[model samples]
Target: MKHLSPKQKASIALAALRGEKISKLSSDYQVHPNQIGKWKKLAEEELAVLFTDKRKKENHSQERIIDELYQTIGRREVEISWLKKNSSLSYPERLTLANKEHPDISTLRQAELLDISRSSIYYQPTVNPGDIQIMNSIDKIFTQCPFYGHRRIKPELKEEYGINIGKKRIISLMKEMGLNAIYPRPKLNLSSSDKQHKKFPYLLKGLPIIRPNQVWGTDITYIKLKKYFAYLVAILDWYSRYVVAWKLSPTLENIFCIQALEQALKINKTEVHNSDQGAQYTSLNYINILEESEIRISMDGRGRCMDNIFTERLWRTVKYENIYLNEYADIGEAGQGLSEYFKFYNEKRRHQSLDYKTPAQIYFAKY
Candidate 1:
């Protein structure tokens, strides 16, 4: 009559399924043969569940049903609690005394008994008008020709939309919106060379990336909210196009970029890490992490775009698909939305460049 924990029970169940004799299992586990026999009997009666696919299928189905039921129960419980507190019935007697007279009692009772709700739920989000219009225009133009720089985009705005905006303003806006021209094109912004950090040559020029951890590229992109802006830095795998790690910050500081690099390194160490010669990337603190990890540092050639093409493509996809679709009201909303989009990008959305397979699929294909 000894009580067994779930782990002990699982051990017994697994041992019984492996066809080990009861006496042998008892001896090995330092328990009595009767205990082993009892465990075996219990295991045998439920053992089919361990091997049968239907058991897992049913469990998953039941879990989903249970989650939905719990949600419904929670909502009804809130309503019942509200009615009890607000109505004439005392809190303790509300369920019994107010059950018959209350109109919502029936629904609450149904939800409580069945573990489901009958109420409809809807969500309405507020959006900024100016941000919406700007995002819409950015989406349209970026989709048509991703290689068009802000110089070309600024003129297009005036000629096509009749909006007279300066190139500097458009460039600033483009950076804020995380829009960038495709790689191998002209550089939009110049990196600082005044820093004392050592710059490395691009080592991926002729290298064939056949494995996931062979090469990693990092870059920073701007994210625009309704009234403010944030910066996002991501380290991506060159071979699989998978984002290893990412970070968001209010300013284009070196700390946030370094934090992202540290997170990515913790997941998996890469043989070579590449980045543009931006000050943040070239800072001593940022470069030291790679040096400590023994990761080969690679920097894009001055004003060269093709050196970091993959990261550019990632920015383009994110901006067009998620960032430009809606005007985020704050940094929190932008972070949440971008996180969801990245999840979809990594796990669900298929990329043509990756043979129509998701980044997760390609990244784990070899394993």
Candidate 2:
């Protein structure tokens, strides 16, 4: 009738099992006779299970453990075999490992396991040998005629090299190479404009650039590399055609433009700094630097390349004199080649407009 320990219950049940009467055991243990009967019934039902054979169950448990161990060993073996096949291999070599002819693994599954794209497994890239020659010819054409758009370039391509091509394809290649006509055009893509940034007026329109520090103009141009293109930003002294500072970047980020500005300011401070309406020049950071230096900020009117006339001319001179002369393999190679070229440009190359005087001679005339 009251709470009883498991030991007490088991003892009562044992007495019942030993042929002792449940009513006598109940009276002896102070438990109800009905409670003793319930305990005895439970023990009798479970006693058979306690004495039954367990070897079969043990053997079954052992077999399951052995199966799991075998599965783990198989997984490790597959991993080891894969590593042995692909160890220390290059990406192209590893790509050859995915076989569509394999019986078990499909191409998709093999690609996923190899951490590569399924398309890459089957897609073979073929380069058109004529593209390089055509691009080089295009570069020469663009260098000679900066104002030629894709419409004009199409004919020039056919006339110059007999390489007849469509307008759309030429436009795509020009876009990729970052080339556009230098004439006053509606859309300029080299530098994009952000609607959020502040736009400034063109201040060099009537201003006389009499000396080295009177006005400095900056612009970005694309230099063709062996495989791709690189962007070059330069700050030029308008009056002397002296390159104050130049930076080459793989991107069109404002940081590189700002760095070029910083470098120019370090060399000599100009009274006015001019650039296109491109976002790189109008960016808050670029504006802040010019404002901080007390230099007047001037931006070309939208679609006006001549607003920064000296820099545009500088780009032409750079391409014809140096860029077109050398085949730069990479950015580093281009940088090195451009460094020497700019050195020659500033120190040795004489400008007919500058009375045959070099930029260094004019820039450092007073010094």
Candidate 3:
């Protein structure tokens, strides 16, 4: 009949848990026998809650540790990619590093981290003389008429250069050159949608570009070299026609595309960023970056080359004004030459469409 403190009840319950007789515990604590049983039961329940709370805390700690480890891995991978892109590490050294033992990462992942082609690790480069002429012809025809697909390009080759080549060869060469006809085609409905890559509807249609960074377009083009050729990926601000950033890579590898995108984002964030439905743009890494910044991702619908007309025009301007006029001995030479020309194009060259104002002028000063 006496009121007991929680501490007394808990002490009685613990004594019961320790295998002391319930009657003796009740007598010792001067509590009712039934109340002793109740205290013991309550104590048992509380003990379970305590362990449940401990497990939850343990799980949270484990999750935090896992997240930190993943962050560390991500940082390491980013560092490795930066070194591969900017550092003067030789291919063999990169290969060695990629192949090095890492508990959390695999060789394939490490190769991706290094931006080195896994096959190129052992394969040596040899010049195929026959491709030189054909590729050169393809480059010219594509530049003159970008909308020319392999089907149309085949005929142009025969009529213009009198070189009759099969459609399959043209297709193969175009694929190797990473050339896609700049025009709309029927969308192939996939059986299952890729959750990782979300294909966005073309958002630029009927959208007027009244200011800079309203819609920035990016594209890739073939940069011809004497012995070997490389691809150039560039980011162009649509309204101002400003070449925000550009990167040259020896292959149509997606890494360069990502690098250019990151560089452009760093300099200026656009409201609606447009790119052709290239794998590079649709990549999860690329999409996440844009989405995280709250920028809209717009893809040029197939065959809607005009959707990215400014970027297409930029390629023409770059090639006619600089690439063709200057013969590049190597990738380094091409990068250097294009670097200077882009500087001139952005800083000096006047655009009739821009009301005779330069891209830099319009972008920086006007709008």
- Measured over all alpha carbons after superposition, the RMSD of each candidate to the real structure, in angstroms, is 19.0, 26.3, 18.7
Instruction: Give lDDT tens digits, candidate 3, residues 104-199.
Output: 655444554555554434433365767767888898898888878887888888898888989878877777676666556642211112446678
Given candidate 1, what's the lDDT at residue 342? 82
lDDT of 2 by residue, 9-84 (tens): 8866877999875533443344667778889899999887865787766666787879989987976676567767
Candidate 1 lands at a TM-score of: 0.58
Best by lDDT: 2
- Of 1 and 3, which scores higher on lDDT? 3
Q: After superposition, how far is residue 200 of candidate 2 from its true place, in Å?
A: 1.1
Q: For model 1, name the residue pairs that clash.
A: none
Worst 10 residues of 1 by lDDT: 114-123
Model 1 Cα lDDT, one tens digit per residue, 168-195: 7677666555555655544445244435
Worst 10 residues of 3 by lDDT: 186-195
Ranking by lDDT: 2, 3, 1
Q: Estimate each model's TM-score.
A: 0.58, 0.62, 0.66
Q: What is the lDDT of residue 209 in candidate 1?
A: 90
Give model 2's clash tally.
0
Backbone clash pairs in model 3 (N, Cα, C under 3 Å; residues 3+ apart or in different chains), count: 3
| lDDT of candidate model 2 versus the reference | 0.75
